[model samples]
Target: MSDLSGSERRKLEKLLGMGSGYVLNFSDRTFGDFFDEYRVEIDNEQYKTGGTSKANRMRTFWTVANNHVLGRVIEGLIEYANEEQCFGDSNPSLVTNCQNIAKRLLSDQPVAELDALTAISDDYDFEIVANHVREAIDKNQPEAALDRLHTFVNKLVRITCERYNIEITVDKPLNSVFGEYVKKLREDGHLESAMTDRILRTSISVLEAFNDVRNNKSLAHDNPILNYEESLLIFNHVAASIRFIKKLEASIKTKSATALDKTKDTKNDDFIPF
Candidate 1:
């Protein structure tokens, strides 16, 4: 029997302690092979340690510690697998560490970048996006506001789909979700018919674009950059589609003004109908 590696022994101890009354067994040579790689990183002897944390000294030690711990977590999982170590002892704990990393990664936040977060708060939270929409509405720029809203909704849908690795070319499902969001705004009085035409037009465009993508057809016949690009075709389209909100508001204001004018004219004509 050869000697056991440090991480291998660490994993064994963890499994034995966690499994407690349960049966536990693993070969030492296999365990050593499992941890051979990460154990090197634990010592920082491989000359590769951290990514974002090491690059920027501003990152807190806690963040650095979290990432450094991941090296062991990786080693632990490897050892667990090699030893056929049942009981789910090491994995569940190590997975928690991986889950934490995944959660933070999704934030699109870098510990070194403070100013970057202000612009990208929306990338993480829709509530932040909603607050921005509220400000645009308060500014009486509902058209500009809806355009922003459309962009937000479209991106939300696309991201959700892409994260699942579904076909991005087939966007109707995503559009369908945003359509519901738009209808919600309409029901809440955030949108009206003057806007409906434009919304419908955009919806049709999205549907059309989706068809084009699915059928290998296109109006422009060439892909655009961002919203106008070869990629992000739908994202860019949704962003551009909100321009009709202005016309919706304008049409309403015009109709109301005309109605008021007609009433004043009748009063001046002495049309009391007596």
Candidate 2:
């Protein structure tokens, strides 16, 4: 269940046009489609009964959804309202109020880091694994996501290696692939700070141990899972490393593009008429 206070919930209900029997500017079909985009089944019998209004359905959703899903749904509604011009001169503060509520609801979620992983790649396999991790995290069950997170990291590292022309085999474990990527970054002069380099080296061992956790202590097998706090800690650690790599790769692309532009300019200069 979400942690929204009663006043906050009422504010959201009013801003979303749910104070009446409606929700935002969505029709019945469009409402279902909107929820479906986030994998939320709002039409389930559990959320619907005899003459249950759309407002009530949304209220039910808020009552049962975890913070992560609740935050996403709220943000979706805000975006939809903006697109539909639901907030006209009649209610000038509607958008700001909605945004403030969303910020409070999502304040402690690790949504940005999770989003960063998918931003790094659009591979079908990567998205599938990323979604599983997201579902687990949304349901507040990080332990169940451990195996999927490992697979996601492996895919990310392999993609990074391929992008940089670093040799990697499928059989190589996550730590090995990641270690090689780190070594390449250092060799290519991308590792500018001693502290950053040390962190990457530490992540190598962390991912090495993660293999064992995925195999033995995770949902990958019939063994007891790690406790929630430690699982969350591991998730945060791995996510931070992924965010760092994402920035590093982005910087490399920018530099390569700049160099290519310079080369083109040089060629253009040489082609000028005498």
Candidate 3:
């Protein structure tokens, strides 16, 4: 349903395969109508793609998009089936149990492979997010940026873990930060009740989602030069965000200072009117 390119489809399939590694067969059955989707190339995907289909132009894109979706579906089905049987035919209700099993099965990945994968993850996928961040910050269009905010938060959380080499944990208290934000806004005269509320809500929701995902897998303690570069990126982004928030706070305080000055001047003039 979502716009998926040929390469994006491939990555999703890979994720499903890893998540459902216990399944015996992931792709034997036909990918039904629900799974079949055509891949279309937008302008940006052009840079990521290789040369054009010089031979059999009609069939080239059709195969790339159509087949990619079908293959991904089959792979996802395999993962679903594997997840169903993951706990030795019993339901994996306890989080620890599932985590333990996943760790046992997957924790032994080669250092080089992990290094490569994390490097891949570090390359920011700025698809919808580029526009969202731009619009949100520019016109203060929170509604339009909600979807991108979700992605940005996840990216932030992951980068945090990557840089700090610490486990990411999302507890109830930390999760309530967004809720607390809305309450603060309502109590303060700084923001409008509606628009400010939406922005705060979207920002927090994205953060909560980030917290949920950041700890799903642990990174090895060691990283290559490229990994170090990724961590640097994480550091830079985090610092920038913190700086931006502080600047906004200072701007608000500046406005308050100006208001106080104006009020004092008006009162003095009123009292001394000749």
Candidate 4:
């Protein structure tokens, strides 16, 4: 042990403490034999007095320490096994799994937020767009993810147009869809709250900037590769927008339904159709 390098001594100490039992038995002796030739030569005459009792006390201390150390080592080994592939850059599943585990352990946020955003209207188109975005993020393809966000905005606009019975061609630009849908939402009084309107307007500006980035700098066009920061920014913006829009749309539909129910009641004359 004295002759061994510092790291090697530490490794041996760890290995020695990893076994079970309160005393060094046949198994422990067998392990020590691996370094038999390298054991430091002892000058026994210098400390012969009371050496046997000291050695016995040292052995007792080590036995207790070994039991404690082995328990911790087992725990560490299990933890490492669970996260072995998590830091591997190539394994998306491992990364996601590790994130989920850590998130579960550390967070008190609503579990619903971790779930995929639910569409307030027909979900087929929304799901398709969301899946594309999810895959792009999982694969670390930030540019593709940003492009998917742009695509999602287009889909959302189209869905809004359909909801309002507004005619729009498939070839219409994103700006046109945004302008028309927002105009209709405003005119119909569905977007009544000043704060809500501000959020929507601001989000539209973000969407426009996102569109430009996708077209001019993201992988959607001939440009530089998207870095983690840029991609994460786009992802957060896109995800926030999707969650807000879906919740808002769902609330409006609920309001509309409630209003319609009131209209059917002859006693309620002030019911307004949405």
Q: Please, what is the TM-score per model?
A: 0.23, 0.64, 0.28, 0.54
lDDT of 1 by residue, 100-152 (tens): 44344323311222121122225656657656654533232233333344444
lDDT (Cα) of model 4: 0.52
Model 4 C-alpha lDDT per residue in residues 1-274, reported as the tens digit of each score:
0122344323323332322321122233432342232221112333233243323322332332222222332233234434543223335554344334333322322122323333435678777876776655444344556776677767766776788877789776776676677777788888769887877777767766776787887767778757756776667666676676677777999999998887778555666677
Local error of candidate 1 at residue 171 (angstroms): 19
Pairs that clash in candidate 2: none
For residue 226, model 3's alpha carbon misses the true position, in angstroms, by 16
- Whole-model Cα lDDT of every candidate shown, in order: 0.42, 0.81, 0.39, 0.52
Give candidate 2's whole-model lDDT. 0.81
Over 1-274, each residue of candidate 2 has an lDDT whose tens digit, in order, gives: 7888898887787787776789877788898999997678888877775347788888888887767668878888888877888866636576677677777777657544766656357788888998888777766678878999988888888888898777887677888888888898899898889999998999899989999999999988999999977998888888877887888899999999999999999999889686
Best by lDDT: 2
Whole-model alpha-carbon lDDT for candidate 3: 0.39
TM-score-wise, the better of 1 and 4 is 4
Ranking by TM-score: 2, 4, 3, 1
Cα shift from native, residue 234, model 1 (Å): 3.2
Better of 3 and 4 by lDDT: 4
* Candidate 3 lDDT, 171-264, residue by residue in tens: 4333354455445545665465587566656656545654433333112112221232333333334335434434545576799899999999
Q: Spell out the clash pairs found in candidate 1.
A: 223-230, 224-228, 224-229, 224-230, 225-228, 225-229, 227-236
Off by over 4 Å in 3: 1-172, 193-196, 217-251, 266-274
